[model samples]
Target: MAGVTAAVSARLKADEARRPGFYAAGSGPLPQVRGSTLPVMELALQITLIVTSVLVVLLVLLHVQRRILLTMTGLASALRNSG
Candidate 1:
């Protein structure tokens, strides 16, 4: 079983190396750092987080506005009926 597993692993590694930009470095099975790719990945992650945060804030504000409008509407109706 071990021998078969090793054979398959080796074949997979060979296939991965054949692809473009497959950098295998360090003492691990994966690349530790491939040129300037890490920074690009970080930037992408940051941008995604910022976009998500802004959307959440906007949605919360909209909900608050809707609740305020509903409360005002109820108060106005009560005042009219009282008079």
Candidate 2:
């Protein structure tokens, strides 16, 4: 087993020696990295996705229910027709 390994290595060494340049020749394409690719990290990830989507819509309008936020801002039909 050892002998086989030695033979393989020897062959590889011989092959390398025969080669004039780029013996291992970057076996593939991977050499393009010039980055600070920034518009301030794309404006800081669009201002952290607009401040976490306006802090998750102000924490879901501070957890809903003021009569479902005055029936979604129609001011619950003018405060239920002014009592």
Clashing pairs in 2: none
lDDT tens readout by residue for model 1, 1-83: 99999898787778767886674343256645557677898999999999999999999999999999999999999999999
Query: Over the stretch 1-83, how does candidate 2's per-residue lDDT look in tens digits?
Result: 99999899777867875775424343465334466456678999999999999999988887786658767677767788899
lDDT of each: 0.84, 0.74
The 10-residue segment with the lowest total lDDT in model 1: 23-32
TM-score of each: 0.57, 0.27
Please report the candidate that would top lDDT against the real structure: 1
What is the TM-score (0 to 1) of candidate 1? 0.57
Candidate 2 similarity to native, TM-score: 0.27
The ten-residue window of minimal lDDT in model 2 covers 22-31
Off by over 4 Å in 2: 22-83
C-alpha positional error of residue 76 in candidate 1 after TM-score superposition, expressed in Å: 0.5
